[model samples]
Target: MRARLMEATVELLVERGFAGTTTTLVSERAGVSRGAQLHHFPTKNALVVAAVEHLTERRGEELSRAVDALPAGGNRTRAVVAMLGDHFASPVFAAALELWVAARTDEALLAAVAPLEQRVGREAHRMTAAALGADESRPGVRELVQATLDLVRGLGLASTISDDSTRRRRILGEWADVLDREMARA
Candidate 1:
């Protein structure tokens, strides 16, 4: 029942933005009684948080697998591009986009998301820093990855909302350039 509701919420988040995704819609789409949904999540935010948590865990696992599968000297650029490709093409990211907008006005949503964002950001920075042979303790490594992540995410948003495949390819190309430069330096 919990998974059903969460799945429904994710679908609705894609269909309707966060402002429009109500518990009522989730319950209806899940084909479950409202009472069942309320039993698991008293508030819509609880469900959103749960869905986001699930996504974060799944994304982490996917990233770990990708990193493990990469060749030595590592082709970090291609790995990053592939990860971004999969991420941007996913409907789940549409749900995340909705949650991001909602978090601006909802304190509870922000609270739930902040820690997950920090964890993911740290992991991303660690990957970039390790690839570049930079110390993880340094701010420069983290800042660079942060900028890269933002660029990729922005391109993802553009793809999702505007169907901009060219923009997506451009973003991937840009990452490749950065990676080439960094790997050269390394």
Candidate 2:
């Protein structure tokens, strides 16, 4: 039921936007009673926070699975950029962009997004470090992991709003080139 409510909240976010989303609307969309929504969420921001958390976790899971296909080595550098490039080209990316924009003015939403963002950074570092088989504490490897995460966000933004696939590919290629260099160094 919480999942259903969160899913409805996301849909509401995409459709009615933050200003328009309400527990009443979310409950209606989720086919739950208003009392049920109150029982589950207690507040609009709480529901929105859960929705954003759900979206972030969903994306993180998908990213982990997609990047898992790459071999644990320098070769995965390009594959990381390409696979994530493909991921950002999806509708989910656009939805995420919407949530990010909403989070900018909403402190509660920002708070909700903060831990998830940090977790993503940590996970990306772990994955890249694993690919390079680096000592987890290595400084250079940490930098590369951070850069890779930034690249993913930039690529996701470009893919979400840009009309040019060529541009997205070019950026992905550039990120791949950078990763290729760093992965070798590590």
RMSD (Å) per prediction: 2.8, 2.9
TM-score of predicted model 1? 0.80
* Overall lDDT per candidate, in order of appearance: 0.72, 0.71
- Clashing residue pair totals per candidate (backbone < 3 A): 0, 0
lDDT of 1 by residue, 1-186 (tens): 777887888888888878888999889989999988888889988888787667756775676677667676656666666576557567877887788788878888899877866776677666655544544355355555567667767777777857777667766777767756764554
Predicted structure 2: lDDT? 0.71
Clashing residue pairs in candidate 1 (N, C-alpha, C atoms within 3 angstroms): none
TM-score of each: 0.80, 0.78
* Ten residues in sequence with the least summed lDDT for candidate 1: 131-140
In Å, residue 162's CA in model 1 sits off its true spot by 1.2
After TM-score superposition, what is the CA distance of residue 104 in candidate 1 from its true location, in Å? 0.7
